[model samples]
Target: MTTQTPAVRLRGITKSFGSNLVVEPLDLEIGRNEFFSILGPSGCGKTTLMRMITGFETPTGGSVELDGKTVDRVSTRERDLNMLFQSYALFPHLSVYENVAFELRVRKTAKAELDTRVREALALVRMEEFAARKPAELSGGQRQRVALARAVVGRPAVVLLDEPLGALDQKLRKEMQFELKRLQREVGITFIYVTHDQEEALTMSDRIAVMSRGRVLQVASPIEIYDAPTSRFVAGFIGSCNLIDAVVESGRVVVPGLGAVPATLPDGTADGARVVVAVRPERMTLSDQPIEGGFAGVIAERVFLGDEWTYHVKAGETELTVRVPSGETSTALAGLPEGGRVWAAWPAAAGRVLPADETASPLIGSPA
Candidate 1:
C-alpha cells in the first residue's frame, strides 16, 4: 500500500511586504481531515500565512505543498482549495442554492452531479430549506452557513477559513463554532482555520499553532498547548496565569515573600538563575490555615464570575490570584473578604519555571 501524504505542508515559508516582515520563516503540517487552527492576536501574521497558503500572497522563501505536490506557482483558482472569509461573501443577486452551486458551475461539472452536490452541501449545513433565499434575506448565522456550504461544495483538498464567524454576535459565534466543527467532520476535508480567539481555537481545533509577532511559538493539541506551554507568551496568552518573579534553588523556586515552592525546571537552568514561576489562577487553592511550601497572605480582592470566584491575595510584594469554583467548598475556602488572612497553595507539579529573560518580553496585540 502507498503512504498517505499530509493535506498541507509549509517548509520554511516566509513573507514580507517591503521592509515589514509580517511572517517569519516557519514550517507546519496539517493532516488530512484535521481541524487545525492558527491562533494569534492581530499583526501576528496568521492572516498573511493563510494568504500564502491560498496563493493570494506568495512567499518570499520556501514552498507550499498540497497532497504531496509543490504549488508555489499555482494560482489561487487552480489550487484545488477554497477560502471562507468573515464577510461570508455570498452573492446578493443569487439564492443560497446558486451560491453553493457556483463552484461546480465554474468548473463545468455535469448537471446531475452539480445538482446532487449542491443539495448535499446545503443539507450538510442544514441550509437546504433556505436554498431559495438571497443573502439579504438570511440571518448572519444562516449566511455564514451558506458561505460554508459554498466553500465545501466542490470537495476541495482543503478549506481555509479566516475568522469566518467574526461577523456574528457573540451568541451566534459560539453557536457556529460547533457548527463549523460538525460540518468539517461531515465533509471529511482538511480545515485550516485562522483566528485570534483562544477559546475558539481551544474549542474546535484538533491541533493548534500559536503565533506571536510573525513567529510560531508552539504547536500542539489544545490541552497540551494550555497545560505545557513552551514559553511565557504562550502561557500568558492562552489563559490567565499568575506569573511570579522567583529565583531557582535546586528543585524549587523561591519567591521573595512566599518562600520556596516546588516547580519543574527547564533544562540547563542554574540554581541561582532568575526565573518566573507560572501557575494558573484556577490551579491554586486558598485556605485560612498556613500551608506547607505556600504563601501566607491576606485576601486583597475577590471577583465574582458567576460560577467561579477569583481572589487576589497579597503576600509581601508578590501578589497571586486564585480561582475557586462557586460552591460550598469555595465559600468555605475562598469566601474570605478583604484583609482576611489566608494561605495560597498549589501542587508541586502545577508550577512551571521559565527563564526570567523570556518570561514576558514578547508583546502580544489585541485579539483578532
Candidate 2:
C-alpha cells in the first residue's frame, strides 16, 4: 500500500535573523484541497511561515516539501503557488482584466486560452462586470475580489493569503470571508491562509494551526479549538474564556474562594497539583434563585448585545462572565439590576483542566 502525499509539508523548518530566532524548528502537513489557516497575533511567525512556503523567505534549517518533493532549492517563481497579500498589491495602471491575466501573460499563454482562464477567474469572484475598470477606481472590497481573481487565475496547486481582508470594514470583511470560502470550495485548491484574526480563521478554515511566538500551540477544527483548547493561551486566544486558577484534588479542580468546581483532570495531572480551569462564558448559566450545586454571586454588570446578554457576576473572589442567549428565557433576567444576587452553574464537563506551567503566561499577546 502507498500513502498519498500531502499538498505541502514543513519539516524542522526554522528561520532566524542573526541571533533573533523568528520561527522555531517546526513540522506540519497540509492535506490536498484543505482550507488550512495559520492563526496567531502579530509577530507570531505565521506570515514568516507562509513566506517560507512560498519560497520568498529561505529557511535557516530543514526543508519545505510540495507534493512530497523537497523544494529547498526551488526559486520563488518556480514554485506552483500564488500569494494574495494584505495590501491587495494590484497594478495601478493595468485594467482588472489585465491584472487577472498577468500570470498567464507572463507564461506567454495563447490569447484564446488566456482569455478563457482570466474570464473564468473573474466570474468566480463575481468581478467579471468590472473587468474594464482599474484598481484605483474600485472600492476596497471590489479590489479584494480582483486580487482574489488574480491569485487563482492560474489555478495553482496552493494559494497563500496573508490577511487579505484586513483593510475592509467589519461588514465587508464578514461578507468577503464567505466569498473567500465559497471561492475556495469552487476551485478545490489547497489554501494556506495566514491571519491574526481569530474569528476569520475560525470562520474560513477547515482546520487551524494556532501559533505563539515561534511555535505552534495547537492544530484542530474550529469547534475543537474553541471547546477543548490544549492550553490556557489557546483557550483565551481563540475566544472569550474564563480561566480560574485552581488545584486538582480527588479528580476535581478546587478553585480558591469559589470552592470545588467539578472538573475532569487531564491525564498525568497529579493530585494537589496547581492547574487552571477554562470555561467558556456561554457554558455558564445564571439564575436569580439559588440552585443546588451552583455558586452564588452578585451581578456586577450587564451588557445587552444584539443576540445575547453578557453578564459579569461576582462569584466569591472570582468575577465570572456568563453569556445568555437573548430571547424569552433570557429576558427574565432583565429585571435583575446590578448587585442582584444570582447563582452561576455549569456542567462538570464544561471546565477543562490545563497544565499550569505549559507556557509562561496565560494571556495571548502579539510578539514585539
Candidate 3:
C-alpha cells in the first residue's frame, strides 16, 4: 500500500482552434502504475487533453511532464509512450504477428530478440495462437486484443487507450473491461484511458478525471466520485440522483418537495440561502407509515428488473425513483400503481445540500 510518484503531469494545459477555446488551462497528475481515466461527453475536451499527452496534438499553453521532467520538446516516439486508438489502426495485409512486431522491427531489434518479445506479447494477451491471422480474419474483440498486445510489446512507460472497446458488443465490452484491468495490473505501467462511457470509466479506473467544456471538474476514485461528488455535475453524471431546490437555515436545508435535511452550514451557507439537495434512489425508503425526517409521495409506476424492482413516484411537480428488493416489494409496488398513495422516506443523512445555482448542471462539466 505504498504510494508512488506520478509518472505523468500536466500544468496549465490549454488547447484552442480559431475562435473556439476547446480546452481551458488545467493541471493533472498520473501516478506510476495507476489506471487513470479521462472521461466526459463527446466534444468535452477529454480527447483533446489526451491528444496533448500522447503528443498527437500540441497544447496552446502550458507544459507536459513525464516523471517530473518537462517533455514538451520531445517527439511522440522519443517520449517512451504508446497509444492504442479506437480504430485499432492495424495494417490490412500484415498478419497479427507481423503487426505486433512492426515497432520492434522499426527499432532494428535483432531477429532472435524480436521473436521472443513478440511471442511474449501475444502470450500476455492470450492471443499467441492467433498470430498467423490477419486483422480482417479476426472478430472485432479479437482485433482489439491484438491491438492491445501490440501496444504493450514495446514496454512503454505509459499506455494511452482511446475508446478501445467502443466497437465491441455489450457483453464483450463488459468482459474486456475486466480483461483490460487485469492486463494493466500485470504490466504495472501507467495506463491513461479516455472514454465518454461512465460505466467503463467507473469499472476500470483507479481514479477518474471527469471533464466537461475542456476542463476537469473532479479527480477522485470511482467510489469517491460516485458517492461524494464535489459538484452537482459529478453527483448527477456518475449516478441517478434526485436534485431538489432548497433553502438553508440554522445549519439545515429545507428542500421544497422533501423536508429539511440534516447538514452542516459552513460560514458561506447563509440562512435563507438557496441551494439544491441531492438524494440517491437507493438511499430512500418506501413505507406505509410516516417516518421522521422523511417525505411522502404517490407511487407513479413500477417496473421489475430481474433481481430488483424500480418504483417511480411523483411528489409535487417532481418524479422520484427508488429501487427495492424484488419479490415482495414488486407485489407491493404493483399494488401501489400510478397515483397510488405512498410515502417516500429517506434518512436525513442520505441527502446532500448544494448551491442552488448548480442543480441544472450536466454530470460532465462546470457548475450550472
Candidate 4:
C-alpha cells in the first residue's frame, strides 16, 4: 500500500503564556481529504491548537507543516488556509455575493472570474438563491451558509472550523451537521474542526482526537474510541460509562460487591495490580428473573428518554445506570416500581480494563 503525505503535520508543538502551558509538546498528522475533529471540554486547548495551525497564535516550540512544507514562518494570508468562526464574521453591509467574492477580489482576480467563483461557492453551500440578501436580513443558518461560502470561495487546501455550528439551535445544528459532512466530501479538502460537543464530533469526523489538559489522550475512529478507550478520562469524557474500580487477580477484574468479571487486561499487567473496568450503560441487560452471573439491585429511579428507558439501579453501596431499549417486550418493565428488584447482566467481553493511573490528575478545566 502506498502512504500519502499528511495534509497537516504538527511536530513537537508547544504553547505557553507566562509559565502557564496551554498546549504541551505534541505531534499530530491529518490525512488529506480527511474530516478530523479535535474534541474536548472548554479550556482544554482545542481552540489554542486551531489558532496555532491558522497562524493566529505562534507556538513557543516546534513547527507546523502543510502538504510536506514548513509553514511556521508563513504569514496567515500567505498560507492557503481558510477559517470559519462561530460568529460567522460576515460583512453586515455587503450582500452574500459580495461577501463570497471578497477573498477573490483581494487576490486581484478578474471580475468575471470572481463572479463565477462566488456563484459556484454559493451554490455549493445551497445559498446561491440568497446571493442578493445582506447578512443582517438573513437568519442564523443562512448567515452560516454565507460564511461557509466565503471560506471556500478561494478554494483553499484546508478549512479550519472553530465551532461553526455553535450559534444555531439544536434542530438547525443537527441539520447543518449533515450539510457540513456532505460539503467536506464534495470539496475533497482537509477539514480540521474544533468543538466541545462529543456527539457532533462522532457524527462528522472520519477520525477523532480526544484532548485533555493540553494533551491528546487518544486518536481513533468513533467506534474504537468509544468501545475501547485507552484511559479512564477518554472513556468517561466520550460518553456515559460506568467506571468501576477493580483489582486484577487470576486474569479477571475483581469489583467490590460485584465479584470477578471476565476482562482482558493489557499485556504485562501484573497480578494484584489495580485497574479500572469500563462498561457502557447500554451494554447491560435488566430483568426481573433471578439469573446466574448477574448483580442484584433495586431500581432507584427510571427516566423515559423517548427511545430508551434509563434505570438507576443500586446494588450494595454502588449505584449503576442501565439503559433498556424501548419496545413492546421491554415496555412491560416500565410499570415496575422504583423499588422493584432486578438483575443486571452483560457479556464478559463488554467490560474493558484500563490503567488506573489515568485517574491521578483531575481533568483540566474541570470545575473545582
Between prediction 2 and prediction 3, the one with superior lDDT is: 2
Report lDDT (Cα) of residue 135, candidate 3: 96
- Separately for all candidates shown, the number of backbone clashes (residues 3 or more apart, or on different chains) is 0, 0, 1, 0
- Native-vs-model 3 lDDT? 0.83
Number of the predicted model whose lDDT against the real structure is largest: 2
Error of 2 at 126 (Å): 0.7
Per-residue alpha-carbon lDDT of candidate 3 for residues 1-368, written as tens digits (9 for 90 to 100):
95665899999989999889999898888999999999888899988898899888999999999988898989988998999987999999999999999999999999999999999989988999999999999999899999999999989989999999998999999999999999999989899999989999999999999887777888999988887666677677887887776787676777665656644344455677777767888888876557565567787787878987788888776678887776547355556657787777767657666666542333222222
Q: Report, for every candidate in turn, its global Cα lDDT versus the true structure.
A: 0.87, 0.89, 0.83, 0.87
Q: Taking the tens digit of each residue's C-alpha lDDT, what string does model 1 give over 1-368?
A: 97679999999999989999999898899999999999999999999999999999999999999999999999998898999999888889998999999989989999999999999999999998998999999999999999999999989999999998888999999999999999999999999999999999999999999999999988899998888777778888898998888987775678887678867665556678787878998899888888887778888898888898888989889989999888834455655678999888898789877656643432122111
Model 4's TM-score against the true structure: 0.95
Deviating ranges (above 4 Å) for candidate 3: 1-4, 262-268, 327-331, 359-368
Cand. 4 Cα-lDDT: 0.87
* Displacement of the residue 28 alpha carbon in candidate 3, Å: 1.0
Model 4 C-alpha lDDT per residue in residues 1-368, reported as the tens digit of each score: 97988999999999999899999899999999999999999999999999999999999999999989999999999888999999999999999999999988889999989988998898889998899999999999999999998988898889999999999999999999999999999889899999999989999999999999898888889888888788888889988998888898876778888888756666666778788878899998888877688889999998988888898999776688888888732544777899999888777778778877773432222111
State the displacement of the C-alpha of residue 137, model 2, in Å, after optimal TM-score superposition: 1.6
Candidate 3: which pairs clash? 275-356
> Residue 66 lDDT in model 4?
90
